[model samples]
Target: MRLLASSLLLLCLSAYSEGTVISKEPGESIHLTCSSEECPTYSNEYHYLYLYYTIDEEAEVVFSNIKSERFSPRGKYESRTKLDIHNRTITLSNLTASDTGIYKCVYKKSSTEKITCSVYAVFITEKTPCSTVSPAVEPSPVLMYIIFVCIISVLAMWILMLLILPKVQQRFIKRRAMHAHQSSADNVYEIMRREEGAQVAAPIGLV
Candidate 1:
């Protein structure tokens, strides 16, 4: 029995010591949780629950269960503080040094008058280094393949035109010369035939 009790006490200590120590800049937000399986449920009504914080040994109210649709967050909050009553947590946005301290959650079970509490400690630092992330992606092979095919097709067309155009032009010039020579030879033969006919018909006896 004593051993069991010792183990339980150690577990509780571990749970208390394992809380987050938020260290963030003034412009950043700090989240603190008072979460445990044994944590109490939030009150549906304003009369049964209260949340507080202790700063410089002075207790300051943080939230009270209220009828106006949300936690009645208090004192320097002014939209800078957020409370999650159901989760037993608080988030302080746009934090300043004055916002650092111990925070608590208090829930009262009305029928039996039972009270449950959870606490968390917060610490704020002056600054931290900036962080950035860049994603890496593999270049697609399809674009490379398309570019390769286009370059080869253009080169092949250029080579074909360079090698074949001069040959085609030379063949055309030779055909034109052959046609001109044949026409000149036909004209000379017609002139000869006409002179022979005229001579035979006119003066055979005198010659």
Candidate 2:
């Protein structure tokens, strides 16, 4: 009986000393068991169970058993943690990278008797979100100014052509009309000179 009890104690102590590593992504949940099996049952009045997490060598209490069946959570875990005494587990939800650490449960059976349960080394990996929206690029003021200048120049050239084309056409038509009148006058004068020459030459021959 004595040997059997000592072996059982050794087994329990070995189980407590063993460590477990748990890995998860951010915003996920994890269940941390205090012991491999159900935690040693104790009277409600004498039971004092607390869960703690350590990060960057700093430890803080996560779950605290107030009295018999009452419990309280501290700090950032006020709403994200759920403690199940019946299952001897603590479920931490909505995990983040800052929550990566070592977690352990401590049970104070009496004033001088305390038991620390299994330790969990938790690792929370943060995934960066991919962006599909393209960044807004501002229009270059110099480019815009150049485009505006080009448009204005084209419009100015078109308006200038519209104003000058009718004047050019009128000048061309007037020059054509003057040249036609000069040609007609020259043709009539040449015919009159030829008729006078013929009359003078013929009358002299007849006389």
Candidate 3:
């Protein structure tokens, strides 16, 4: 009988050390387990279990054993929360972005012993596309200045061409007139030299 009692006590101690609360995502159910092995004259009598949640600096009691299905919330959380003591689980439906927080489970037994466990619940928050809706992505002032400079350069080149074309045409006309005058003077000098040579040949023949 003593050996049996010793074995049962060891088993109960091992089970009491195994209570745990698992971390879960928001909008999903989480199970908290409090178990003990068979022991003589020791019935598992839990007085109450409290579930608490803190979200964004607001604290609230999510579940309690006194009211099985009557866990209340401040606002916008009346119908979205549920607690089941039979399964030691808490279910939150249609979780929103504001549901991300820490959850703690406290269990009180009739023997005045308390067991506590904690888990983190994370809710996904949808963020807007920052790259598409920003006004800072407009065209830079440097790019606009570069475009203006290019336009000014093109206009300056066009004006320079207009100013140089008339001077080039006048230079070409003067060169052509000077060439014609020189050719006419050379032709008159050649005719006079030819007449002198003819007179000299006629005199030699007469001698």
Best by lDDT: 2
Candidate 1, after superposition: displacement of residue 130 in Å? 11
User: Which candidate wins on TM-score?
Assistant: 2
Can you tell me which runs of candidate 2 are displaced by over 4 Å? 1-18, 37-39, 43-46, 128-207
- lDDT tens digits by residue: candidate 3, 1-207: 323332333333223234332333345544433222221111445446655664324465554543343444435555765665555556666664345444556665644676666443332333336578644333235333333444555567677788777788889999999999989999999998999999889989999
Off by over 4 Å in 1: 1-19, 42-47, 66-69, 85-88, 110-116, 128-207
Please state the error at residue 147 of candidate 2 in Å: 58
Ten contiguous residues with the weakest lDDT in model 3: 33-42
My TM-score estimates for the predictions, one after another, are: 0.42, 0.48, 0.36
* lDDT minimum window of 10 residues, candidate 2: 5-14
What stretches of model 3 exceed 4 Å from their correct place?
1-43, 55-58, 66-76, 109-113, 127-207
Mind giving the per-residue lDDT tens digits that candidate 1 earns over 143-195?
23333444555567678789788888889999999999999999999999999
Q: What are the lDDT figures for the candidates, one per model?
A: 0.56, 0.67, 0.50
Candidate 2 steric clashes = 0
